[model samples]
Target: MTLKLELEQYPFVDLSAKVAEIIEDRFAIVLKSKLTLACMYLDPRFQCALDENEKKIAKSYLVKLHERMEIKRLAKLDASPDTDSRSNESDNSNTRDENENLLEKMLQSKCNQAKNSHQKKILQLLNEFDFQSERTPTGIDIIEFWTNNAASRLELAKLAAVLFAIPAAEVICERDFSTLNFVYNKLRNKLNDESLQCIMFIKSNEEIFQMQ
Candidate 1:
């Protein structure tokens, strides 16, 4: 009877270990997603969950995202009408004496140095251990925390806004499909592709329109 009971329990013990291993493997795969890891790092509650290498990956992803956003913003500014006026002013200003040209070069050099220092500050903040300290409160709201505390670090706040906006599950996609079924049913089957796309876009962003 003792041998039979051991045999009966053996499969259950083996299954439990397999289940644990599967769960660990799933987590490893999820953490391997660069955006997911970056989002976790941005959340103060989960900042300590990452290992050193994972932290490095998350930081690099965030910096790249920030740089991309900065590039887009600069492009928009360059395309604006004010930029044309500024360029004309700069062209005319180039006719100044040698002393003025030297002053302008010195000012540009200082601006470049300031910009480099700001970038260094951002990198230093990412590497700091203070955020992982026990003093960070439990159950803090990630969005609110970044909004209120990261004013000086607008790049981080912008990245957090984007990372947090990404849906972590399929519920949103499922909901959109459900909405599509209702919007494009048997009676509405004749809706053209362009019209349907416009409708879906409006539906997906209804909250923004409502706010306005």
Candidate 2:
């Protein structure tokens, strides 16, 4: 709306041109970012941020991530060889050849089982929209909420755990820059990158010890 108003009032102005360019760049970044969509769905603050259409968009992306994770998990399971009857391998060779059809059927059944389980999880997430209405009597600890309910809300909890781990601002990066400067001075220039990182992590989380 601001851009539309600016275009109508200052169609020939340089500021309007700059604004248009900036809006286009920012819009492209936001539209291309799956993180933005994931954040919108998982963040309690954004429970009411998106309209119905936007919620649908968020849901599609969230479900896509969930399905992708599930597929990878199932693929890993499928790739794992059965080892239970390894001791009788020589005798089992003939049996294995005969049971190829049964093995294929079993593999198909497991794949279907995995897909069904994933679908159930997605449905649970969809039905749990009311999770937004559950008041956080004390305060908002989004990560803790999901972590505590992980057992019951496995898929949604995993999604929340991942999304919550992503820092929402550049403040942590800026702080790390300052810490790097302090840690890698002229006298400490020989510190390897690994050691520097270790020092920085401790410095950043030092407050955790103070809490005790």
Candidate 3:
């Protein structure tokens, strides 16, 4: 029979030369007669620059690289959760400790609260209280009486406690992001890869890049 027919029986031998034999087997007939069909239909200059084996090898490298990268991505994305779950255990432990300590503190605080409440009730009964009237004729007298006329007086001092602690916590962080938001809008789709990287670097580490 033909050389092809003889080689076909040696499947095991051809299997060793897998990619090469596959290309030859698939394209031999097409290369002979169908060449005229492909001559003007396909670009000959690009085709002639690389042979079948070279093209196959280049494609194989890219495919293998792509497969390796995809496998790495999937491994990162689809991996099973860590069985060593310390966060839940730590949270439960913190909660348990918090509950125990809170109960103890509340119990201690309750004793002090009862004592204070009893003292307050006794004071309320002793004082000539007028719930309808806003002003006490002797505001300082009641405070002084409560403190037993101490040298350092909370009532003698008119310290208006305004609860608010500052001229606002000057949060400059959000202001920077807001300013950057305007800049980012200007560069939505206009910028390429390099310019974006340069701008981000400059924004974060301006002193590092600039000398003067």
- Between candidates 1 and 3, the lDDT winner: 1
Give the lDDT of residue 101 in candidate 3. Answer: 96
Which pairs clash (backbone N, Cα, C closer than 3 Å) in model 1?
none
Residues 1-212 of candidate 3 have per-residue lDDT tens digits of 14556566667775645744765766655444332222211222233433455444433333333344544767999687866664676658877788879898997799678656644543332222212224334324333433453333321121101111112235645655665576578548676778766776577557677865
lDDT of 1 at 61: 82
RMSD (CA, Å), candidate 1 to true, equals 8.1
Each model's C-alpha lDDT?
0.77, 0.74, 0.45
Quote each prediction's TM-score: 0.64, 0.57, 0.20
lDDT of 1 at 52: 82
TM-score: model 2 vs. ground truth: 0.57
Task: Using lDDT, rank the candidates from best to worst.
Answer: 1, 2, 3
The number of the candidate with the highest lDDT is: 1
* lDDT (C-alpha) at residue 91 in model 2: 81
Q: Model 2's lDDT to the true fold? A: 0.74
Show model 1 residue runs off by greater than 4 Å.
Answer: 1-20, 81-119, 128-130, 135-138, 189-198, 201-212
Best by TM-score: 1
